[model samples]
Target: MASSRFSAALLLLVPALLAANRPLYAQTVTAGPDSSAVAANPVADSLRRTEKLFGWRVTRPKKAALLALVLPGAGQIYNRQYWKLPLVYGGLGATGYGLYHYQSRYKEYIKGRDLYLAANGRTPINQLPGAGDQVKKETSVDNIQRGIVFYRRNRDTFIAYNALLYGVTILDALVAAHLRDFDISDDLSLRLEPALLPTATTAPTAGLALSLHLK
Candidate 1:
């Protein structure tokens, strides 16, 4: 009886051990219509293939620069140079401020000249007064002319500076993009050495030699 009981227990334990050792194959049973549709779609497969072919795996420095030329700081952002964004914005801000101030002053000068002429309708020779009036009118005329000239100069300066800023920003973007993939390693080093030599002369003569190396 004990042997029969042992045999029965062994049979039960054998099934349990077999179940534990069996590989659990997880069959992905898709029950939805969407899964079937995706599996049957040829367009999606083609799109995936196209995406793999033309994916985001390369950077173009010239294209980045062109994008920056279209919009400042964009290329730097693309190149992941967050620190340079402020400099680019600051340059554009300065140029814009200069232009605005120049325009405002120019407009004020024009308005003042127009009002003065309207009030004093082209002063004739007889209407020309004593030294004080003469000086006052001459000063007004000179002030207006000076304001106009300075405004034009400032405006032109702003334009030139803005153009320079644009060019520099584009160039900087191109350079940054090119350097984005640069490799810097701990193995790089630069060394400089100097040697001194004494020459047999009447007095003590010395010669110096320098050596430089980069690795």
Candidate 2:
């Protein structure tokens, strides 16, 4: 009798135990992330996965461009291309120096011309701002005016050069980043083969065919 009572109690306890664990089982099934849902949503998937540079998640080209825009040579450094730094800096430096030189000369000529005119033709051309014997040896108003124009033009040219070189460096960084994974292996090949060509005259002709293979 006692055994039968214990068996009845166990039977009741089994259903109660199952009822208590059912919600927990369902909770466990729903707790973790749903990979299929994440995969189905492209924006969520992209946000979940990212390419990183310098601990920041960003595409290579975009990162390189941002770095380059923030500071020159930073992009090349990020790309691990140390050699290009010299060329980039050299071009910018040369253009910057030329800009400084020409701008100074242009300003000097302008000042000299203004001073000559202000003195009401009494100031000797040689005694002008830039024509002070120790500086530029400009002797005539015509020569001073010509010098001003020449220096101004050269300054403007150097300004263009500086802008061009700066842009080139930024573009180089962007392109280099894009081509970082490009394949230039020996698998690329060109071949010449003989082929038959059909003509409108209903005759077949022999021809040499050139084929390019990329693998």
Candidate 3:
């Protein structure tokens, strides 16, 4: 009985195998992507051009940092970050103006003190360059001295602050350039939820956790 069943199964399989092996109509039915559609796409063409343009590339971060170190705001310009240029220049310019203004005030105080001394039997006052009529008011010696101390301290403080600003500009350029390609896009998402999870103590526990998913 088993031999008879085996023969019947072979008979059923043989015709199916023969049918599978047999070829159908010879008409060609090739299926593939349409090359013309890709070629005709404007967005694809633009992307191809961009790829070709960047083929001859140099290191961007290094170049940006170098430009910034050499000249304040130059790095931002190289990175095509135009908005930062004003801030860099504004900081440096304000510092320069402050140094000039405080120095001028210090000179005025000195001239006033010297003029008062000259009028009271001391040596004649030595005129400072571009010293205006600010000393003509004849303020007291103590007031002139106090002005000198105040302006000098302010001037020194601003000088140090300016130096720090210069360093900060270079650092900003370096870090900004390094992170220029960092993705801060709308694809970023965060989620928080309460859930129960099994812990090492073999008991289910409720916990709070944060999750971030970036697309």
TM-score of each: 0.54, 0.68, 0.59
Cα lDDT tens digits for candidate 3, 4-23: 44335434643443344322
Stretches off by above 4 angstroms in model 3 are 1-59, 118-131, 183-186, 196-204
Ordered list by TM-score, greatest first: 2, 3, 1
> What are the Cα lDDT values of the candidates?
0.58, 0.69, 0.61
Worst 10 residues of 3 by lDDT: 31-40
Better of 2 and 3 by lDDT: 2
Q: Give the lowest summed-lDDT range of ten residues in model 2.
A: 23-32
Candidate 1's displacement at residue 140, Å, is 1.6
lDDT of 2 by residue, 77-174 (tens): 98899998998788678778989988988888888788888988787877654443422476678888898888998888778767766776777777
After superposition, candidate 1 runs with Cα above 4 Å error: 1-59, 118-139, 192-215
Comparing 1 with 2 on TM-score, the higher-scoring candidate is: 2
Query: How many backbone clashes does every candidate have?
Result: 0, 0, 0
Best by lDDT: 2
Q: Which candidate's TM-score is highest?
A: 2
